[model samples]
Target: MSKQLPDLTPIGVVAIAALCTTSLLVGVRSLGALQRWELLVFDWMIRLRPDDPPDPRLLVVGITEDDLSRFGWPLSDRTLAQALNQLQQHDPAAIGLDLYRNLSQPPGYEELVAELNAPNLIGIENDNVDPPPTLPEARIGFNDLVSDPDGPIRRNLMTFEIEGKTRYSFSLRLALHYLQLKGLAPEVSPTGAIVWGKAVFEPLTSTSGGYATIDAKGYQILLNYRAEDRAVETVTLSQVLDRQVPPEWIEDKIIAIGTIAPSIGDVHYTPYSSTSSHPFMAGVVIHAQMLSQLLSAVIDGRPLFWFWSEGVEIAWILAWTVGGAAIAWWCRHPLLLVAVSAGGIGVLVLTTWGIFLAAGWIPFVTPVLGWAIAGSGVVAYRAYQSGRQQQIVMKLLGQSTSPEVADALWSSRDHLLKNGKLPGQKLVATMLFTDLKDFSTISEQMPPEALLEWLNEYLEMLTEVVQEHHGIINKFTGDGIMAAFGVPIARQQPEEIAEDAYNAVSCGLTMSDRLQILNREWQQRGLPVIQMRVGIYTGPIVAGSLGGKERLEYGMIGDSVNIASRLESCEKDRQSSICRVLIARETLTLIREQFVVEHWGPLALKGKHQMVDVYRVLARQQKTGEVPVEPPVDFPQPKR
Candidate 1:
């Protein structure tokens, strides 16, 4: 038989599972929990990178508790002027006073105002604080950092509209001033992003990276934080005022001054806070880090964090979903599947980590979850299909077939079965039909219960004989049985077909002997004894499952099957013994060499148009220790 069509069930299952899982993850991501997980993973990826050395061009002067004790809260204007004067003398590229100097703390206000007029000094302001009244707007930048809802600073606000005018951030102002000193001024790219040399600073959107619903009102970008230990070079405000700081540390570097004392309450959480002993970084250090980031990207060619478009990200997640399902489909063993699935998840995580290291921010948690759910769906579907197939096979073939045959049928199910049912196939094999002689008369002689018991005992013996000879009892018609050899699995070789015919003839002979013993036992027990008629034929027949799903059975249909049944009841006066076996010329042709058979002549079988030569299989051909010549006779050819 030709091979059946390839099964599309697995592919279908994978597609639906992957699609559904992808959709679910996408929906869940929109609900925010998945987005938060992805952000956490992003932080971990950042933390996992090799430590970046402290940038030599950035310095932070933080006022500590000692400074507060020495100069009191809100340092006097004279003290502030002294610090600025010391920093200016070092010839720094730009000085960013992270402290809001809008309010006056006077004792020497004139001195503070005069020092703030330096061309490179940038004053800080916030929504609640104004820039120094004496300082020009060109000399001011807002010292505000954007924090996520969960309280970690991860983005830098570059510029925002205030009273229909653009105001720059503290970090941006310092970075731009430092770059301008090196003759590398910022310019707007064709796409409207900030461009300096080959670096393009793209602003972040509400959906950038792992952020799903961020308030992206101002121009912002992902803050790529450096290692905590070497984030920036720092010195105390008292040290700056005492002129103890090295001039080289300030020369041509962007200097940021702010408070770092715990009592000052200027500390904020950062991505490294979770793993660091100090879970917060001073606000001054964050501004220095942001400024350093911009300078490095523009001058040193360091990369900025990037992200894939929404469409590309979705496709990437779907790819992993399909991959997970494919892995499950290839691995049939549960242990192997589990092992491979774990490995698949490991590979996915590593891949995303590697990409993150390259400054490409893509989703990790969503794809991992999607992969797991899709693989599980496929596994569950396979389990269901396996149980369903087992039930259908048992229902159609029954339990009479031998274990080896049943296994073989199951193994070749991909080729033998279609849509949970056996497809019809044409094969050249033997069919055996058996009937209890005078079954009607025997039934009348006993009550229903006793008759059922007697019939079951005889049928059980017949089923065992058929199974032993590798034949399947296709179905039962009242007291008669229709059994087939070389069924479910087609015989590919002519020799195999001939073997099936030999087994069918041998099975009939065994039945004759088995019936004799059964009759003797019944006679001894004072129960009614009965005879049997068995007819065997070898020819082409179409075999497959019959009836709908609710009621099903394996059945054979062909002229050969009808002939087998007709031979069993052809002539009642022809019984020569208690159990009789008659085979057509076709079956006799294959087993004639091994059996002694009597030629009963050609006769027209009921419902058959042509005459069929019948033979009586008496017993095994007696061997005389010598080869015997076979007689030749003309045989009728079967119509195709």
Candidate 2:
């Protein structure tokens, strides 16, 4: 018979569970609200350390507290000129002033302006809502900070539109200044982000093209602070007015002179901020870092995106969803399921980190979560549905009959009903045939009502024994019962079914001994004593519904079954009477270790040409228990 599909309720439940899990994962990730505490821990663990060398070409001309102290409160313009003059001695390629010069202040302001007008100096500008025109000599660069959705300073502004014209800022402009210094000025892209002529310093590290992102401390480069006078051979504003400081100091190095006093507040947050360096110094260092990055690009070449992050994210989700579902379905245990889920998460994190570090790109996050959620959801749902179905089946079958019989019947009910026939279906089973020896004579000797009572009592005891061994009583003759094992269901090992048969026989022996006492009491009243013979055989049998529509019985019908009945009947015949409990050789094979059997030579039975080997089970050998063997060898024999 064709196998029927399993119950629908469980499948439905599993599908629902999978849907719920998918929805949850997608919802959480889309909102960016997933509390990734574990990811947070991982992020911290893998945070890059400081003191690493930044690109070397960039150089900082920091305006410090010492410069302020030496030149009076907010440093005067002449003092700035004097400082710039000293820095020019270094012969640096380019210089960037991180200070805004929109409005002027100080005695040496004009002199400072004259010095800034020099070829390599780049001045900072803010192109907020309104922007000033670029200086004729010095290149204007903007200093704009962009914040993340959570209000954290995470990105840098590369370009801004001022009055319908695009003006690039910070790193982009610094890169432009370096190109200008090489007489290789770049053409600006329409979007204001990319620089033409030279490849844009598009570090794959940042979401934006121009800037290389720094950690929260802000400094992208290590700050080497300069102290007063020691900061860079500082001279008084009067000394520079008198041309006392050497002209060589003001001839070559690109110089930046700005206030670093806490009161002035020119300082800003940077990654390299420390107890020694102020924020102004940090900004100066960042400017140097950007310049170095630009020069490196001009030299070593900029890195490209290794993988399309958007595509990666989508693929990850698909892979996780399909793969996770497969894994969850394959594993049934709760702990194993959890381990699989964790393993998936680990793989996802590892993949994300690997791509980020190696290719400098962030892969898609949504797809990975989708896979995991779908996988876990399906498995959990299936397990729940399975449990519910089991409960329903148990409630329906548990109390009506033997648990083993109930389980088997419930399991095979669909197949049996669909096929309409139970017999002729080959199944590995333990067939049991039990009969009351000389039952006809006993019935004839006793009154009808008394005989009926005695038969009911005998059947009840036998039925209990069969139930105790987890066997289903297939049918009962006038004074005989037949049971089966390993059908309607099968176990991992056939030996378990053999053990059940042995247990049933042992139970029968106990019941017989108990019945002996009752039979003796009946004997005193001139009634016949009752005795029974049982035979168990393990082999393939055809089991199904037997008889016509009105009265159908589920039973087995095959030669193995016929042999079992013959073996039981043999107990009464003189020639075959030596064995009280005869079991098939096949059954003996499974239980030879626990049972002691006397081999009964193969017999040629009626209607069968071939001889069948059989064994008479003498006793079950227990480590610490008695073997009950009644009905001595001299018991009166009956004709078969």
Candidate 3:
């Protein structure tokens, strides 16, 4: 046997919950909504970082376009040697040569080579690029930058594996050289973050912080960039060679020397490039920024950017998912649910903005996605539930009342039920009772199968006729049907009340006329013919859903219903013939203008104690005052 599947309610709820969980997890693991949001938040945080003034202890000696024009692209060794000789005399703390100079040049090679050996100077290397020709392993530092997929540098590599050996980066080595004068060194933390004094230089991983998937090599950490507008005090290569710069601007400061020429292709896009007024930063300036950031944390006591562990981030996402699920469960209105979802999103945006500013990167996209998945899924499910419930209510009430009544009942179901019970109410309604004239006689004359076939033919006509006039076929009592109008669903307006009475009276006359046509068809088939007697009454009745929880049906249980049934069995009227259609005084009074009911006043029916006034509904009257023998006139349309 095949496995049994659960119904739609449970299935919808489970699907919604599963979607929320899966959407969040997939985002956390793969590159999707969460990753996109992480990148966006990262850009905002970088731009929002506190703008500090340039460090007074650092300086830059750059090769400008003017210098490149004056000395040409590849300056002679004599030019560099003279500039170094001028800078070293100032007694700076340390000097970092940010240029690649491994090749030998003409004229002053021996002099340039001698100046490269200063104890405080750091030479640059690029093993990943074309290897230059100068300096021992201990004297050279790597000068390569790691770019993201978008070609922007946010991480600063501290150490790299070159030729099967770990080598320090140029910026890292330069910062270390300067810090040595103050007697501070790096210590490895248990969590793998680099700690120096009170500062922790935590390196970013592929999944760390706001980065999605990234190249996480070289033991890199987040680069805390300096303010864009604050430029490092620079002197041209021409100024350094001429010895025109003041000694105080260079004395006791760490001076980084590099080329700032536009033709050198040393430019890179930073977080501030798109938003700030300044242009993109040069590669050497980026290095200087890295060095300054590190020294500031250790020497000036500034905080470094860091992130929470994966476990904490998962918990944070799960918490928001629960909140969204709860809101979905409580809110029912569609508009209110939409407003709530928007509010949840706003809270995430503002909260993440503040959190990133203070505590660095957190999981932003996954949490908001969790809210949307769980919340929207539940709301959509509720909407489906309401629709399905309406269909069920329409089918139920449709059996016993007009289409209008069924619709009204569905629209006001919440108001009708009190704690799962349908409350009883007094209603002004028209009750119709229909009985076949000689159904028993016909059943006896025919065989079982043929009898059922004939009975169905007659009942089918009755059902169709009653429903056409918007009258309910409440119950089939062996040979007859019990129906009620303005029941279960109440009529609030006077026009609607009058329309109910008119429909009931009109339906009775139509039933008689259709039965005559059905009899003509039966007579020609060599079968027994049948007729129906219908009674319509208008009065107060207690209408509502009645019975236990396992089974319930709409009902109008009152004296008015009994009187209509009694009229269906009534024997005679004014002509003392078959009473085909009878209308009581209570019903006739409400539909006096629309129906031409013959007054058969004060007939003492068996069930009632007092004498009741009744009438013989021979035919329906049109606006022209003539009673038509065929189909009844259309009832007046009721005011909405």
Q: Which stretches of candidate 1 lie over 4 Å from their true place?
A: 1-13, 64-79, 104-111, 238-244, 326-347, 383-388, 493-526, 547-553, 570-640
Question: Residue by residue across 248-318, what tens digits does model 2's lDDT show?
Answer: 55553333333445566654543323223442333444444444444544555543223355444444445
Each candidate structure's count of clashing pairs? 0, 26, 1
What is candidate 1's local distance difference test score?
0.85
Report the lDDT of model 2 for residue 574. 34
Give RMSD to native, each candidate: 6.5, 9.3, 7.5
User: Which stretches in model 3 have alpha-carbon errors above 4 Å?
Assistant: 1-20, 31-37, 48-50, 128-139, 162-164, 229-249, 273-280, 323-334, 398-640
TM-score for each predicted model, relative to the true structure: 0.84, 0.63, 0.70
Question: Which candidate order results from sorting by TM-score in descending order?
Answer: 1, 3, 2
What lDDT tens digits, residue by residue, belong to model 1 across residues 1-640?
5433233577888898899999998888877778778778877877788878998888889899999999998999999999999999989888999887778898989999999989999888888888999878887899888899888899999899979999999888888788878889888878879888658989898877788888988789899887776788889988998888988999988888999998888899888888989989889888988988898899998899999998998999999999888888778888999899999999998898888889899988888888889998888877777767777888988897988789898877767767877899998878899997677877887999999998888999999999999999988777878998988788999889889998988898888778778877987987877778898888999988898866777778998889888988888667757667899888877876888888999988888889999988877775888576443222222112
Give the winner by lDDT: 2 or 3: 3
Best by lDDT: 1
Whole-model lDDT values for every prediction: 0.85, 0.55, 0.75
Clashing pairs in 3: 102-133
Q: Give one digit per residue, the lDDT tens place, for model 3 in 1-640.
A: 5432222444456455755675557565566335656665677777876777887878888888899899876878888888888888999888888877767677799888888878778888776553235566665678888876666677888897758999888888888888888899888889987889768877778888767688788798888777675646767888888888999988888889888887888878776776766557778888888888889898877767778787777777777876786678666676887788789888988887787666567877777778877776676665665665554455445465556556677677666754334678998888898876556666777999988788788777777777777777777787778888776677889888889888888887777677767767887998776556787788889987677544566678888888898887776322332227887888877887776667777878877898778788766666666565563432222122
lDDT: the better of candidates 1 and 3: 1
